[model samples]
Target: MAQSVHFSTPVDTVVSRMRALDTALPERDGLAVFNRVYLTVTEEFDRQLDAGLFPDRRAAISLDVRFAERYLTVAEDGRAPACWRPLLQFRRHPGVRPLQFALSGINAHIGHDLALALVDTCRTLGCEPADLEDEFDRVGDLLVSLEERVREELMPGPDLFQIADPLTHLLGSWSLERAREATWAAARALWALRGLPDLAEEFADRLDSAVGLAGRMLLTPLPI
Candidate 1:
């Protein structure tokens, strides 16, 4: 029997899980690096919710919780998608920069899991993606803002050593804006393919694999 989708997951539960990871994981650990960045974003969302920033509080919370659950499940279960495999495999390597780990994780979560989460939210709410567009855009804006903060916080200090570094170039190659645009398109495409389960699965799998390949490249251990 197909499991029923429920939209009642409390925001506190997911926030607590993130807080626990923040306390347990080392600051420089790849998962920790990503977790810190993500945790900040989640916290901000929660504050926004309290402020009544969302027009549909239930939908916002549902989307937010569902989006987070995907990452938490992968982290705890070790059943990560291909896009997340590189970060998991290379997380502890001394050669990988903190920014690389952070961005790679973001790449995987936003690139693949985000689209699926959108679909998950839709099913739970008995609504279409169009119905949740406002929440999606608001969340996307928050992500973009957090990405800026993450870059600023993780970027190496200015110096010739930092300016000429490969990490700088590698980080420069990817853009959160482009990723967000792609994710929106993917989410809409997946929703369109809702009736064609096999095709949708194939599309999602291809997306997962492709994002994973990019993550692997991003995590290439640098001599610096």
Candidate 2:
């Protein structure tokens, strides 16, 4: 047999898949750029989970895997909802910076996939969205740190940048903290609407379109 691999957990499985992508894609490839960032996040989640950082480990694992699977699905098939199209479609454009790709992917994943993942986790665990609040907050804290790094490393330095810069406005406009809060609210709303499949689908569709719009804006090619 050419392959015989076993994952210790679902997190491990995703981590491995991400590692594979990281290795397979070109260094400058847009998905590769985002893949590296996401891999770091997933690894941190796994480490924190192992260290008992999350109170409900099972719920955390479920949510983390569910959320990641959404992105992986798009990555695997090259077919995704509107929310993911901007990043995947513009991935190879030279004008789109690595930071843009990274943030765009995060925007789609957190703004759209994450909310649905929360509802998925709630149903899988036979619980409600409130039960996963701790995990949600914990992950949000991680994304906040990621956002901070994106700015520090990607934004222009004080010597070169002005207050009226478009890039400055773009970076400032996107906030993971606000996105997390909105996703939490969305998850609650989605869980409530689960009983009404038609309405829920419509709501989800609108959300997908809105997130795609945000993602497309984030990916606006710059002269940088």
Candidate 3:
């Protein structure tokens, strides 16, 4: 089940909560690894918002906050899709590389949470996913940019890229571009399923499990 959040100011609330998590969680914790990446993105988005990059700031903020809330909700309620389960469950495992932790969170959030967030934003705005396409594209671009940083900051040294390197192969398998496209399609499908809650839940569950499986593989507790 999703946790209920009461935000007097949606954007500020989400950003502050993420910052708080950043301060509270250990630097090496899996969730903390992802939190750092997400916090950077959120700060950038807030800067962009202040600069008037979004045409409908209110709508964009609503979407952004709602999207973030999905991830945070999982942290609070522990009732998350299978996709996020691995990250939460392995947060304290010293064997998982920070890169793996970061990517696993990205997979869970983009692969599953983003689709649901789209539906949530649509409901709040009385609009459709198409109506928020610009915001989605903008946010996706930000996330993609962050992935490059993730690679640079977390990828092992050049000496470790041998043919037998499991980390290299694991990181190579996932692509932010492909994830974004799939997420968009999933969002559309989920929106279409809104009228059938049971079917929608089933679809969401499958997505969760599939992404979770990928995350599990990524967090294979390599010899790094």
Q: Please give the CA lDDT of all the candidate structures.
A: 0.88, 0.87, 0.87
As a TM-score, model 1 comes out at: 0.93
Error of 2 at 2 (Å): 36
- Please give, for residues 99-194, the per-residue lDDT of candidate 2 as tens digits: 788889899999999999999999999999998899888888888897788667766667656532767677667888888988999999999999
Per-residue C-alpha lDDT of model 3 across residues 1-224, encoded as one tens digit per residue: 97544334567778898898899888899999999999899989987887779999888998899889889988656677688989989988877889999999998899888888988999988999999999999999999999998989898887776523788887899988898999999999999999999999999888888889988888888774
Ranked candidates, highest TM-score first: 1, 2, 3
Which candidate achieves the best TM-score against the true structure? 1
Which ranges in model 2 have alpha carbons more than 4 Å from their true place?
A: 1-7, 156-164
lDDT of 3: 0.87
Model 3 worst lDDT run, 10 consecutive residues: 2-11
What ranges in model 3 sit over 4 Å off? 1-9, 161-164
Residue 182, model 1: lDDT of 92
* Steric clash pairs (candidate 1): 83-212
Question: Candidate 1: lDDT of 158?
Answer: 68
lDDT of 3 at 152: 90
Q: What would the per-residue lDDT of candidate 1 be over residues 1-224, giving only the tens digit for each residue?
A: 97644343488788889999999888778998999888889988887887779999999998988899889987777888898899999999998888889899999999888899999999999999999999989998998888888788777786747543777888888987898889989999999999999999999999999899989988989875
